[model samples]
Target: MAAVAGIWLYNKGAQHLVSLAAGALLAMALLRLLPEAQEGLVEQGLSHNSLFVFLLIGLVGFFLLEKLSLFRHNHHHEHDGHDHHHGFDKEEAGRGGWMILVGSGVHNFADGLLIAAAFLTDVRLGWLTAVSIGLHEIMHKLSDFSVLLNAGFTRVRALAYTLACGLMAVLGGVLGFYVLSGFESFVPYVLVVSASSFLYIAVADLIPQINAHKGLRAGLTQAAMLLCGVALVWLLSPAHQHSHSHEMEQHEREEPHALMWSRSVL
Candidate 1:
């Protein structure tokens, strides 16, 4: 659905869509993913600094890949038999489309593991987590499609690649469900890597492209779109699980009674 929508709207307001996506990706990393990574590390009794290190490693690795022309998204079509060339920056964009998919694949796989963890902990919690991830992924996938288009992928190729990358989540979920304890200690680090990928894409990749345009009007419009994107993810964040408050309170209340009952029985 997101791919089709993007293809249909590609002719109109594609740049703004990219800006919105960049903003959302930033929010997903900063507001959501990073915090979750920190909490997971703390839960697993791991040093908090490791999160930062993983993030740095992810960013630098992506930077190096782009430098090597392996992750370049700049596309220039040289026509032979089929002419579909919209010259952007052929050298810079080379192979970038595949790079984005690879990054997204890693992130989605982590998402599957996280969702599986939530389900193992509690079914209700798992459902809530799944819904949250679904909403965020819709926006994330849309932005990915926009970035691919900017990198010069045809509509067909972009959609196919995006869908293919999305399947990694399924694989992760299966692994997570069957082997939860084995992966439990490692989930936090995976999340950190995911956050790093999003930060690198939003900051190092997408921002430069959008920053080239000058003019107060364009600036203000971009700012608004960016905020809107952040707002979308922020609104959908796990922090808004107020509906679980009653359940949590009830659990707390039961703990003392359960303890007393156990003691009396003994």
Candidate 2:
């Protein structure tokens, strides 16, 4: 519903609005997802080198998939009723249109894993992570809407498909809860993959598209929107996860069985 309303409000200023959404997604990747991934890695006693390697693999994999037409983010410009060639696509869209839904499903699933991992680690951390994920997902879903429309999908169909894909997060969350409950070792690796997905989308798909607007005012607007995106993610993130962890630990000491039971439910 938020995505529908946001799309309606911004349809008139599609380019600027898309740029803003791109900026926000990038910020969410860098400011929120990456940091959380790193923290998860550290907690799991994983090497920083391993995290970087996985991140690189994820980015490269996404790029290669798009290149091979296994996945894509549709970007289109139209003059009159006909479509104009854009950075990503130049002719008719491919038959592998299901790629968008697949991509979105994968992304949302990773988000669920990250959220569940954070919660399993600590309650306040989980709460902040869930809130941040929710905020980022609104813009992400809006982008998905634009992608589908550009690919010649009707708005209703696009919304229906996107909503279905969005529920992948719920599926992922349930899986993450059960799986991570048994195998905490998977958390760090999953978080790293989550971070990589966001980073790849932001840098590979969004930044270049926004850069297409070369006017001075447009440049300034994009810059401001990008910064705002980063700022929002940073602000919403907890000040210090370590501090939250310490508090959780103290609480656990004061009420060991209760904290254990809560953790188990997560």
Candidate 3:
């Protein structure tokens, strides 16, 4: 549904959509993924700084990936005797599209693990986590759809690709349910790596494209759209969970007592 909406919006104005995608990707990486990874690292008694190391490695790895993509594209075009202009060409766009999909898949997979973990702890918490994740997923999917379109993907292909990435969540959930204790330790690192992909795509690809257009009105419009994208994620953030933390704690406290009473009767 989000992808369909993105297709509709793409027909309206793809450039603005790119700006919005940029904002959403950046916010997801910086505002949500990194902080969550940091907290998890701290909980594990590991240095949160290690997250940065993984982040740096991811960025460099993606950079190399893009360079390889560009090289292959240029080589293929050269053999075909076709000349392509520089700056946000088809190759760059395609690279960005693939990178975003990869990042989104990893992020979604992590979300599934988290939701599964929550469910294991408490069903109500699991449902709440799923709801929040669904909302967040919608926002990112819309943004990702736009990027795929901008990368020259046909609407059908873009939708199909996005859905494929979305399915990774189910795979993650299954793995998490079966081996959460062993895998939970790695989720933080996965998040940090996933965040790096978003950061690289937003900064290296999308922002430059947004900056290519010149005009006070265009600049203002782009800025507004970017902020709107960030605002959407902020509004749907899980910060509200903190307010209910005490309630969850109280319920947990009562669970053992209830279990004891039932045992006594038995």
TM-score of each: 0.61, 0.68, 0.57
Candidate 3 residue lDDT tens string, 1-266? 44455445544776777777777767767877778778888899989688888889989987886675531111211222223345648987788778778877876776677667655544544554455455435545766776677778897898999888788888988888778656777767666765776688678767876898999999999999899777765665555455467789999999999999999999
Write candidate 1's Cα lDDT for 1-266 as tens digits: 44455445644765676677677778767876677778888787778897788888978986786677454433222111223356656555546556677877886787788777666644644554555455446545766776676667787887998888778888998898888767666656655665675677677756775787788988888899888878876676556555467679999999999999999999
Score candidate 3 by lDDT. 0.69
> Whole-model Cα lDDT per candidate?
0.67, 0.67, 0.69
Error of 3 at 214 (Å): 1.5
Model 2 per-residue lDDT tens digits across residues 1-266? 44564456555665655555565566555665566677877777877777788889888887886676444543333211335365646334433235667887886776788778777766655665665565446656776776666667787997888888878888888889998999977766666665666677667766776888798999999888777766655565565555677899888788978878899999
CA RMSD, predictions in order: 8.5, 9.4, 10.0
The global Cα lDDT (0 to 1) of model 2 is 0.67
The residue ranges of model 3 lying beyond 4 angstroms of the native Cα positions read: 1-3, 70-182, 240-266
Best by TM-score: 2
List candidate 1 stretches off by more than 4 Å.
68-70, 73-181, 243-266
